[model samples]
Target: MRAVITTEAGGPEVLTLDDVPTPEPKPGQLLIAVVAAGVNRADILQRQGHYPPPPGESDIIGLEVSGYVSAIGAGVTGWRVGERCVALLAGGGYAEYVAVNAGQVTRPPEGIDLVEAAGILEVAATVVSNLDAVRFKAGETFLVHGGTGGIGMFAIQYAKARGATVLTTAGTPEKLDLCRTLGADTALDYHDDWVDGVKEATGGRGVDVILDNMGAKYLTPNVRSLARLGRLVVIGLQGGVKGELNLNTLLGKCATVTATSLRFRPADEKAAIVSRVSDEVWPLIASGRIAIAHQTRFPVDDVRAAHQQLTGGNHVGKVVLTF
Candidate 1:
């Protein structure tokens, strides 16, 4: 098997396609023959030495993939060899084959091609878990940052499909338009006074739920951007990690702040989230209420180019690497 490995973490140039031993399915896992893999900002961070794979996981840089089940491990039932599936992986997706927990794999919805489904698992799991934590309700307001990115694009459509009024921020005008087309009620320029824009859009009440990726850079304003009893779920730290929080503001609004990561979670927890997403989110995808977008595709051998496209920040949806 050929997998993308980093010689030393620094830039996309470090990514190399090298022959590596094929991974075998562990108990309750499935060995998938990769058809396509999704590229994420996390992969870039890992390549640059900023983020490492979780303990006991593969060192390869990928988080989601769509493929055919080539083999199944002991204790796994109901899934068969040659079944088309997509999976949320901890790592090792940048390869010809990957072993993932059976509970974390899902069959692509009817009418969705495997290549597009490659980008669905990570975004679906992330958005579903965070929205579940916030107790998102129909008719409530939801705000998501980085509207053009994979997670943000899915978050906007998923929230809208659940009946929320979705607002999102994007860096470019074209991206903002794409967000609106994807069902966001409003899309604001991230480089401008986005907080003020969001507040104004909601008649100064702020939003009921926020899916934030900027971490410390938006912490204070995120607090201010919340309505009473609002919830802020932070999943990324594109900004610096450390930031001051005003306890008084949170107390006054009865708001809550939470930070979470998907890759480092326990196996059972990941299984639970995957199950919930399959039950709730997959139907919307099948019905076309929620759509998966693939902005670009590269061959597996061109993994470095895939990483560069993601880091360049100009792509409007998920960048996929084809096997």
Candidate 2:
């Protein structure tokens, strides 16, 4: 079986396509014949040696995939050979075959293809878990940073479907328009005074929940942008890690801030997130209530190109690698 391997860590050029032995399913896991895998920011980080796979996991870079089951390990049920599925993974998705825990696998929506399903698991699970943590309610205003990116796109659609008014921030006019087309009530330019824009859009009341990716750099502004008792779910810190939080201001506004990363979680915890995503998000996709718009696909051999594209931040939506 062929797989992409990083013989040394540095740039995308460091990645090489190599023929490796096919991996077999371990207990409670399922071996999948790889069809497509989603390329994410974490993949780029892993490639550059900034992030490593979790303990006892494969060194492969991908965190999610869409494929057909080739074999099921002992103690696994409700699955069989040749069943089409999308699965959340700790690593090893960038290969001809991947073994993922049965609890982390989900059947693709009836009409969606493997390429589309490949991009679903990670973003879907992330959005669902963050929104659940925020506990958004109907008629509330929800603000999402990086609205045109992978997780932001899913956040926008899911927030709207859950009856919240979505307000998103994008860096360019084109991305802002894309957010508006995807059901955002307001799409503000991240370069401009986005807080003022969001305030105006929400009738000066401020947003009730904020899904933030720009962590420390946006911390002060995010706190200021929140309404009374608002919740801010920090899912990524693309900007930086260290920032001073004004505890007094946070207390004055009665707001709460929480941060999480999906890749480093324990298997049981990831299983729980997958279960929730399957129950809440799968039906929406199956019924056409939520839409996934992936803008690019690269062949598995061109995995380095995929990483470069993601690092350059030029792609509008999900970037997937096909086998």
Per TM-score, the best of the predicted structures is 1
List the pairs of residues colliding in candidate 2.
none
C-alpha TM-scores of all predictions: 0.97, 0.96
Q: Give me candidate 2's TM-score against the actual structure.
A: 0.96
Tens digits of per-residue lDDT for model 2 on 28-142?
9999998999998888878888789989999988999999999999999999899999999989989989998888888887799999999998999988887877787888889
Measure candidate 2: CA RMSD. Answer: 1.3
Expressed as tens digits, the lDDT of each residue in 42-149 for candidate 1 is 888888898899989999999999999999999999998999999998999999999999988888878888998888889899989888877888999999999888
Provide the overall lDDT of each model, using Cα atoms, as 2-decimal numbers.
0.91, 0.88
Clashes of 1: 0
